[model samples]
Target: MDHIKRPSLSGLTGKRHSSRDRSKDDAAKGKQKRADSPLIHGQQANGAPSPASRPAKAASTMSIVIESPPNIFFGTPTQSTGALFSGQLRIAVVEPEVTLQTFTMQLLATITARKPVAKDCPECAKKTTELFKWTFITDPKTLRAGDHSFPFSYLLPGHLPASTQGMLGNLEYHLDARATTRPTPSKGAEEITFRHPLPLSRALMPAPEKNSLRVFPPTNLTAHVTMSPTIYPIGESTVLMKLAGVTEKHEDHQQRWRLRKMSWRLEETEKMVSPACPRHAGKVGGEGRGIAHEDVRPLGQMELKEGWKSDFDDGNIEMEFRIRPSGHVRPLCDVDSPTGLSVTHSLVIELVVAEEWAWTKRPGVATPSGAARVLRAQFQVVVTERAGLGISWDEEQPPMYEDVPASPPLYPQSTAPERSTSTSHPHTAGSATPAVARAAAAMNGSGDMTPVVSAMGATQRPPMERRGVTTEYDGPPLYSPSVVPQAVPALNMGGLNDALPRDEDLEDIDLGESMRRPGPPSHRNSAS
Candidate 1:
């Protein structure tokens, strides 16, 4: 039995070989199991979208750049109503050896009326109007891989409205460039496009004369408000308000009335005068496609000052009204920009007598239902940033719109003045009267000491210096004056040139020698 248990050598060798092969097979099975486990991939243990399932972005191979003049804009110069637009464009083919099917450089101005909503509705977003599309079109051509440029300039019609931005719509100008090419190996076409805004300002036009409109039935009132400089500083403004016929005279005693409320609001209105689609604009000039009225609440308020509160028969209420600067938008001057956009400000005055006094016990006297009188003094406001930006107020004078200077006048053609110590030789030329004398006379002639319109000049000006819309518009328009109020305070402020030199630039010039030169004999003596 023991001999039988002791197996043969060949049988023992076969058993050892079987054990080694089993060990190898176990190791291979373990490696395969580890590879099949879910941890190797990004798939979560719980069911969820994998990273590979996300969408892909379109590929691009070209770029563009725009370079505008030091001050890129199209605005009025000689005439207040016209506009001039000018700028430059630079484009570069970033990718190597890319053959483009078509490349274009263009400049366009479009006015759109859009409102961002909680959830975008494609239908509501379609309301828009193109006031005017002045396109600087370049020829379509194939471009070699290199840098390229296109220059553009536009002298818009003087009748063109100024640039305007409002809640209802925007009168925007932009420079756009695009390039299209079929990918080298890909099946479809790829495009590269770029767009940017252009800066422009419109000078608002005042009514032909000292215009006044009265609203009847709403408490039988008369109101006329004059903003000294129709263009006031950004923050606080001194308004010379003339409110007449506010209170009715009662015999026996002079009854005093209180202003229920006196306030002025900046009302922003954007109207789609012209619709994107002519037919869609419909009747009555795009009746209601994109009409927006944003009633800017009064940032600060006040009641009528004591003296002017009583029966105001042309009683002037000189009060300071403060308007807050818009944080989001440039509080532009009243300009009817080319796009169907008009930015305007209205000074609203609401006057109401106490209910008891209005409806007195005298029987059969029918007191009006709406007892409060609402009056609006609509005027163009140059809500400019120059004041806040600390721009040159001393050296460079702002434009004053009170009067128009003779256009295309010959400069330095007027007779020369005799050299004097005051350096006053009368800033203006040809006129017999000194500039200061003329300015003083004009100021005195206005009757009251208060200024009707503020001068956009230095406080120590020579005084004599003192000083359009719509497809056709119905109200006063806005303007920017830079004497740097240059002529702007005047023609939709065509940024007037600095007639006089600046102190900063003067720093570079040694005027001492020039000033002390042994001057020529007086022109008067020479002529004699």
Candidate 2:
């Protein structure tokens, strides 16, 4: 056979190049590809369009403006009438006119669990319920370029639980609004959504203080605890405790319990039912089934080795301490929701007591009997926000103008001059008479004789005229003027005469010196 020229297989065979040379070739190829393609490496070529060049999205936005005060339930859930929440939803349209197909808003309550039934499963983590819904636009409506507002008001049910965030779960409220708009009839509708958080709180009016008594069996020891009905998170709460029956008497020896140590802690407990979503319902058994979870943690604590007064004679121990919620822990307030979510708090106290023996004759000298007991007590406590000065919406005052003052205006002081009357008694150039002494005592602020003095100083009726009967008496004076004593000795009791007017000072004094009355007529004859 003639071998016409067997082609060399080496022409089709390849020789491997070094790693560095292969890398350089690859780099050059990538550069060329980037330069030739307009959208390569997330970069645009000179003639290619930029991201901003794409069709514009819907030129409309939505927002909410709360017009009413903060949402705060005034009293307990059973008694509260609920809070009124009013606000306006504003839609700003950039285009000249846009047709809105549907506009609606909803109030949603959501509960989220920190520890779900199934790890990494969102369906077992959160659940949301719609509380209320508002349909602003039922039919397609056209709005010109500007801002349009839709006012909304709702009275939240009083039975609903307040918003709460705990270690195990969270209860929250939100306002979710959506607006659907279509720029062109041929294009699909675009949705604009807005979400806002709504925080709610409840205040339980303070109630009477509570007193609890606990008696330990087999022992006469009794614990009396006094605590406030409601505890505030921001301020301090006082706990008054009295332990009695610590001392036991015997014929020969005395047995007594001595406090060694005491400690207290505030525990916060949270419970939540983690409901599975439709997709994960099989994991929790079936629909409407959920996994119950509970978490307990301490919000605050204190240990006391001392600070208690022990009286062996009285057989009692008294102690008082103040406690406040830990700021660092950010403890959640008490809440009980209808969605199987709840939070509560309790105060736990533990005391260590040891028994000792002492002779009745020498009670001060005692020896430990090596017998001890641990006394534990737990009390329910409410953790809540302070009920500030803010009153409920129903009790709020009517709106007042800015110029109106918070308090009523004060009236101007009286400008009329006061009547000036002399309080000093008048004197005569002689000893004080009985009438004068009484008048002087009355004028000296020691007695009240206004009517008697006015009658005595009145114009004396003519001796011939009868006083009450409109009849005439033409007879001489009933008696001689001599009947009136000229000089009566002044009273000298308890040096009171020094304060009274003297005989020599009578010249400057005038009896019946009132502006409306004339001086009394002299009883002595004019010649004398």
Candidate 3:
């Protein structure tokens, strides 16, 4: 619209016009510079590389450890109890919440020189190496519940000798690991492994957890042994005995007791009766009846002596023995008889042992005054007769030239003929025969001949001999033969037939009536 001419002097007017134009140009240049800066653009839009393109730093290292329970437990020298031996170690791995999917696990083992031996730098001289092995099914594949069981096993070194003598003091081992990830399908991935070393010392003491099923420590346990009928007959009788032990665990509960098992067998004497005639002097007679009388009496009631409560914590055992007659034993007496003879009989018994049972409250449980030890305990079974008594109903007639009536010998006495002292050695070959004699001496508290000790005159009677036995008959004795019993196949020991002869390692015994002596130590008390 209205064009007005501004007044400008010569120098002032030129400077003002020049300054306005310069300021406008400077503002335009600043805007252009901002457009070229990275702050104004996104990461992708920037020409420089992104942070993700650079390699990441390594994570802090983690540690893994192994542990074991008790070093020893009860075990039998020859048997395997289906349990790991004591003093064995178990391993486990741990991570500090890192990228586990990209990490891999690997194991290794090696033997290092010991401090005492390695001081001389024998590691290189020994030519030892790091060994890698797989056992108990490794590689879990998936890390989830029920995916698989913990596959673990011990590595027995090939070069290490058994622990007897001249063995390495301890063992050394190493474990390795790695991390991995799939960056590209074509190029695959790279592995970064981590190496770790561990050392273990050899066991100088016995293992406490040997042959035990529990993985954790167990409470202290005390044991008590009880045998039924501390006495046994030569034949047709089963001896039932129970071995029970107790454990003290928590204070609120009573001590726990349990039975393990029971096993028994009658060992024949070294001296055997005539196989032809086992009973009478007939063509064939029952075993034991020919030279000596053998009658299998029914099992009697068992009684536990006083103070038996300490025997068990929470455990009890009931056992039985049944003696069955053998068909072969009857054939000895029926060689020329009108009817076939049956001498089959059976003895049945059950033995029980427990791993856990009720506790017998003792004074120590709450007080000390009431504490008492178990002297004896009894577990009995009332057996019902099937065919009734097989022995004769009439009273048994006494044999001629027999000693006064008294308790019969549970074991057969030695009948070895005494040799003349003119021989080279009197103790040789007859050394084992004195087992019974030793027992008799122990019972009589004497070192002299104890087979027969007389307190009246301080005289000893010679042991009886079975060479000649004569009986005077007043008249024709009763000829009524008792019904012979039948034996069950189950009564056979380990499928061995009675007709087959067995090798019995027998010891000589001279047990007689009124001769109270301790019996032989039984193997039944042993822990498997």
Best by lDDT: 2
**Rank order (by lDDT, best first):** 2, 1, 3
The residue pairs that clash in candidate 2, if any, are 431-488
TM-scores, each model vs. reference: 0.42, 0.68, 0.19
In model 3, the runs with Cα more than 4 Å from the true position are: 1-50, 53-67, 70-132, 135-150, 155-171, 177-187, 190-196, 206-528
Better of 1 and 2 by lDDT: 2
Please provide, for model 3 over 470-506, each residue's C-alpha lDDT reduced to its tens digit, 9 standing for 90 to 100: 5444322223111111221112233333333323323
TM-score of 2: 0.68
Task: Tell me the lDDT of model 2 at 159.
Answer: 82
Off by over 4 Å in 2: 1-33, 36-43, 47-55, 118-122, 183-186, 277-286, 397-528
Candidate 2: worst-modelled 10 consecutive residues by lDDT:
420-429
Top candidate (TM-score): 2
Output the worst ten-in-a-row residue range by lDDT, candidate 3.
331-340
Error of 1 at 57 (Å): 12
lDDT on C-alpha atoms for all candidate structures: 0.45, 0.80, 0.32
